[model samples]
Target: MNLHGWIIYNGNLPGNKFLDFAQWIQAAATRKNSTTTIYKNNELLSYLGIGQLEVLRQDKNKLPDYVVFADKDIYLAKQLEYLGVPVFNSAEAIDISDDKIATYQRLAVKNLPIPRTIIAPKIFVSGQLDKTTVQLAMESLGFPMIIKESFGSFGEQVYLIYTEEELYKMVESLQGKAFMFQEFISSSYGNDLRLQVVGDEVVAAMKRSASDDFRANVTAGGTMTAYKPTQQEEKLAIAATQAIGADFAGIDLLFGPNNSPIVCEINSNAHIRNMFDCTNINVADYIIGYILNRLN
Candidate 1:
């Protein structure tokens, strides 16, 4: 448990949440009698064109025994992995989780439960969609559909389309970007479950519910309440995490009919601040413990 680790997070993001994640992990590692270094994603200069496997000019620093990657910088994650350092959640898992389209495809391939999703075709320009394609998505998903931009977080780019006009507008705005259409889980209108999965176990679980919007993100006015997950919920969450090749993730579950749980989304490097505040269970400890268990 005395291994040295690095916690990497996006420094460009305009909030304290990212830093808070890194600091919490650092603290947890300290508690475990381990040393940690926190680095912003940008601070590490990834050597690509220079034909080097290392990053940054400060190569004098010893390579970390393990890395807690909390950023979407896949190149940096992969570079560190290429050097044989263990990165929790892995680069591939983070890539798949960052793209909703890829995430659903992986889950479906594994025969896991997920909401019905239809991915929009790739486009280079923003404009009106061809009637045929729009009609297909509409007929397949129907009204009150969920249009989620492939690369977004915290439900900011996810929309609840209630009519044709709204759908078209949302689609037009996202025409050139990667997005998907999903059948709305009316049963989970404003409520969802978040199971923080660490190394095949559901360490902490919470129910997030919003009164104003369909999104159950705490930043979107959703309130988090500590909740115990059922056997089925835990199973699906653990399976979904593995489906994306992740050892750790925050798995969001939607309430499906007949008391079933559906995979809504996965956060490979899910922030633990909110969960810690809500559940009083620090996943940072779980993460450090999990990493130490694996490394040692």
Candidate 2:
């Protein structure tokens, strides 16, 4: 029997990147002799009324065997899963990966080597941060630390603080937002590794570097190159993915003082275009193949 799949992406998001990801997966599925349909998260409405839980689209009766969730719409993803549809990188994994603090907590519990991190206190009202909490964070992480919002992508909400003043200003600007303070990994200031892990294997890897910025995010002006990660790096990347219960993930690794691998972050729906451009490897192929094997 031929498998049928649904690739869901966020329609509200600007730009074609999200749609592009869905297309890639659809193409891969087609190559594997499976049929796939692409849908926007908004296109599928989740209705919750009393004892009814229904996800409705144009054809409510036409449900796929599995879903390739390429968006961070946790509710929609969860709804599909509740309907007995297998969602790649399950809703639970997407939830953990979507929140930086939650991801860190999960990794920490698993004893993964993540950078030293301290969750910012939740502030009900917006204003200056508590002096005592600020002092404690500074004392623990020191200057030139990293401040990153809990829910962000493309490295847009990440800030590098060089002094107390900078930290205070950044925190003030981010008041009423969930974020964390992390120790700066000087050894990997402008460079990091992106290892694409699918099912227990590292499918593609790349090194991203930015000379003028502390962030190595390719979307933040960083350049990418094909890379060969060490066994330790590969193992850590895979472990980090599994820590969040992700079937596949793009795991970013920072270099420690002694060149050891440190988990920076994991992207459950990591964009594969950059990796393809760098390594000429289509991660979609691996993703589709993994899903096929699991289903079979």
Task: Give one digit per residue, the lDDT tens place, for model 2 in 139-162.
Answer: 999988999999999878888899
Model 2, C-alpha of 200: deviation from truth (Å): 0.8
Would you estimate the TM-scores of all the predictions? 0.96, 0.98
Q: What is the C-alpha RMSD of each candidate to the true structure, in Å?
A: 1.4, 1.1
CA lDDT, every model vs. true structure: 0.91, 0.93
The CA-based lDDT of model 2 is what? 0.93
Q: Write the per-residue lDDT of candidate 1 for residues 205-276, one digit (tens) a residue.
A: 999999988889998889999989999999999999999999899999999998699999999988898898
Q: Kindly report which residue stretches of model 1 are placed more than 4 angstroms away from their true locations once superposed.
A: 49-51, 126-128
What local lDDT does model 1 show for residue 238? 95
Give the number of the best model, judged by TM-score. Answer: 2
